[model samples]
Target: MLMSATSFLASQIRSTIAATVHSTNTLVTSLKSSLGYLGKDSSTSEPENQSALSSVPLRHEQYPSLQPWKGLDRRLKNYGYTMPVSSNYIAPRYPIVLCHGLFGFDKMGPDAIPHLQIHYWKGIHQALNKLGAKVIVARVPRTGSIIERAEDLHKILSTTMEGSPVNFVAHSMGGLDCRYLISHIHNKNYEVLSLTTLSTPHRGSPMMDWFRDNFGVGLLLQSEEDAMRKLGEAAKLSKEAVQEASDALHSYLQNVAGRVMSSGYRAAPNPSPISPLLNKLIPYLDTPAYANLTTTYCKEVFNPNTPDDPRVSYYSYGASVPQIPLWAPLGFPWEVIKAKEGENDGLVSLQSARWGEYVETVEADHWDLNNRWRLKIGYDQKPFDAIDMYMNVATRLYNNGF
Candidate 1:
């Protein structure tokens, strides 16, 4: 997402502290608020909000754009999008923040946290930039949860893009993290323009039951930790409202059915001899929300959202790798998609991938979602034109104001 200068600075200071020093940065000023007490807490403090990923300032060359959008959507008025003709549109390519998924490796030398895959984000970022967006791959000690990640983003906004309007387009769980930041942690003020999720197991993927119980789970991934965090949050509540929420969520998933570990989805190889005992645990857990996030799943996206982001719209995208053999990579095992229908770039179901406020589909796997080695090797795998997906989103976000 796009953010102003002031928002970026406040967030940076917080991230440098939270990640580098292992501290937290919750108290920060909104772009419009005075930063008079930079490091000081208000004496008669009111309820504080969690900060989000720090927004960063961009060099003029970074955005390389015309003036920022001067729109009058009333919502944009406060966020500093300014009011001007559509022709004065600013290319939103200023600074987009890209966050890695759970257990994503972060490199040392502080070399901007190296992305594990060589092709990771290289294609994605290049395409976004060609369409006028600057990509910022962010690293933290851990996102732990979308809410926490969102808070970090909030902090980034404060420290980095202090004066600018920011937009966020997150992948999978990252989208969930954005929602947590905007809905629960936010102080009911700031506007996030738009948010989109990619293959986010919003209702919770059956995969989690496998990852933690079968494979393993770690706080190394903020979103992974969030499963526990939300469980914790869910546990603390006894409100009738909360019960209704869970019930609604439950009812929703039961309807949009898909393959679980059952239906022989985990066949042939069964489990690898190397980790056969561990693999055995997978087929046990029932998939609760495989197809639940579909429009038919629930009446609406499950959110504690206030006003439901009149300005910020929601979208989702997923890959569909159906015929996954009995073996695959670490992130996605072949058992999950083997014998399924359609091709899911590699990990997400194409139908699931289409969950955008507006959806776009490309011929790519989960890896295709990112830049790849370019050799394009894989059966049933399609080489995605990252540039296409990038431009598709860029033109929409910039022109549509999300």
Candidate 2:
């Protein structure tokens, strides 16, 4: 059931989708596979046939590094991005890499973007370019566990930057993926000069559980573990592959990224079965193994409340957003979140987002952290002017040079 098992045949995607998704989810929504930006294609045929994607390739570079990959050069322009003119004064030699988060892609879904009037990476990339630092966009795998993604990041770094990334600006769970790479994956050979994350789920997001409660449609929207977990589970087909990838992800993140990441977004990973495919895909959902896995990566063990970033440092802009509590009567065990109230974002809580040492904050929502929105996080008034905040953060990074 590996994507590489067969050539790029149209039916191949359909068959893989059928196996990957159950009858229920397929009926409700499509499964996540080697999918591409929808609507952009504007094709009469099903996406499987029309899509030229074999999983969004992961390779990115921002600084006009010498000998950049041809593929990278094309994608940089394809994204309609270019070297942004710096503003103010921040002399940092290292450029920036803009990482995409869940639902961050230009073509995530029909309803997710376009109308929102706010795109994080594009907005920020342009902002920082004007702020002075050269910006690069990291087109990472939208689907795959942190380990898999970290490995993808490794590939991108190796090929594009020639082994070391000058800096990174990630968002959402993308932060977690990067964390796993730096803290756990241990890619010491590569040099990561700095990192800045926006609205990332440093902890897990309770939304994961919310998605499980609403599994019928959640899977199609976004996997709780995001793309990495789904891809990791799928990749679990081979343990050696899993270990190798996980090791690489951990090495790059823990070793390389940890040293260079000056700032980042933080959020918690709250477990849930939002997507039926992911829920079913979890080999150990609601079981001891599930708890063990989560616990292993929870605040206590893997990405705990530590001073990991005292040297490189980290800052956050998140607080808990209330969700109606669920009181599962007697059947559920202690492991069930059971509708606990705590610091959170619109989905992930603040306590969950807590990682590294203290930095600073504003009356911002998880999304509001970026200063680009020009408003605030609320249904009534859109958060920070997206353009303003984007420029602020980028300029700040370029100036701070952390």
Candidate 3:
């Protein structure tokens, strides 16, 4: 989830792979192209575009931001980014749609806020827009079963692109939504050119089992009715508003739990009996949706149930923190996942995140994979820039003729 954090750990990654060579070649070519796109020239003795390189903000302070998270914004607003003179500024033939994971909000929050103020994709859309890519941020509900979320996304696609084909770049559960939509929503004529999933739980996560099993206290807090009443009391919002937000929160949690809690796990029976209040509030915990996410279900049922479209290229990019990071809030889950799954991005293990053409892995947690490291308040070390990674994705897509 994209909010703050979670807890659990594992050490082994299990998956059946088809072609490791495809992963290597695609990763190497993409990195090389991205480096070249940023004005680095391996062919030349010196920097090919020294003039363009001179304009880039080289240091954190030089970027003009005391807030680390806003550094990318400052750089974009001030210096701006330009591709090498040899390459085209605008790349992708089709529009790029950014699909967000759980807890993702299309706009910042509430009706009064401006769009993109606190985007789920952070400044990625802005940065891509600047580079002449046609980027549309899809606003599906933060949580829901793949079908429910996909339905929402399908409606958005109908309105946004009419029927034009698009390249989708999704994160976490968003990838599942994309896969669901691509496979099921055939009437829409929405030709999905490529699907790139980032740190998605393809085979599901055991963390969901742990949360549904032992965390009764936390579940009580998230149970729809409680969250709504609490917010209603705290914010003094209208009854209608509170109910709506509460319903959304509940739906989100339903999908979150649905993504991992299934029949195969050691988790106690669905509609966890640990908390009577939670059981009452979330009576429909074990649905077909939830069942679809279990490793057993996914491997034995869902994978075989869902067929990959030969026309649409599929790529997966997974991440791992290796160790607990400076983001203390995310450390618990990261550590837990590390211990149990070998290494993870605090949520989905790298193995669970793999799908089609497996891309290179990164030394980043799930949140940081979306450039959340930029928002680390106290951390001074610049880990990595997700912007570059995204740019590289767009570049590779462009190079491939879509």
lDDT of each: 0.45, 0.46, 0.64
For candidate 2, lDDT tens digit of each residue in 1-402? 566555566578888888877776453233222233343544435556335443443222322332355334323432333433323334346766666665444333346466544445444555565656666666665655455566677677677776544666666666665665554444356567556666565655555544333432122111222323433442435656556645543454343211111122222334434555675565333321122123223443335322243235454444333332223221122123325534444544555555553333433444444332332222332223334444555556655654
C-alpha lDDT of residue 385 in model 3: 65
How big is the positional error of residue 331 in model 3, measured in Å on the Cα after superposition?
2.2
**Every model's Cα RMSD, please?**
20.5, 23.8, 20.6
User: What's the distance in Å from true for residue 164, model 2?
Assistant: 4.8
Ranking by TM-score: 3, 1, 2
Task: TM-score for candidate 1, please give it.
Answer: 0.50
lDDT of 3 at 192: 88
lDDT of candidate 3 at residue 156, scale 0 to 100: 89
Candidate 3, residue 11: CA error in Å?
78
Q: Could you tell me the lDDT of residue 212 within candidate 2?
A: 31
Candidate 1's displacement at residue 49, Å, is 56
Q: Which stretches of candidate 2 lie over 4 Å from their true place?
A: 1-91, 106-120, 163-165, 187-189, 212-297, 304-312, 319-339, 363-379, 398-401
lDDT of 1 by residue, 297-324 (tens): 2112233232244556776666554344
Deviation from native of the Cα of residue 42 in model 1, angstroms: 72
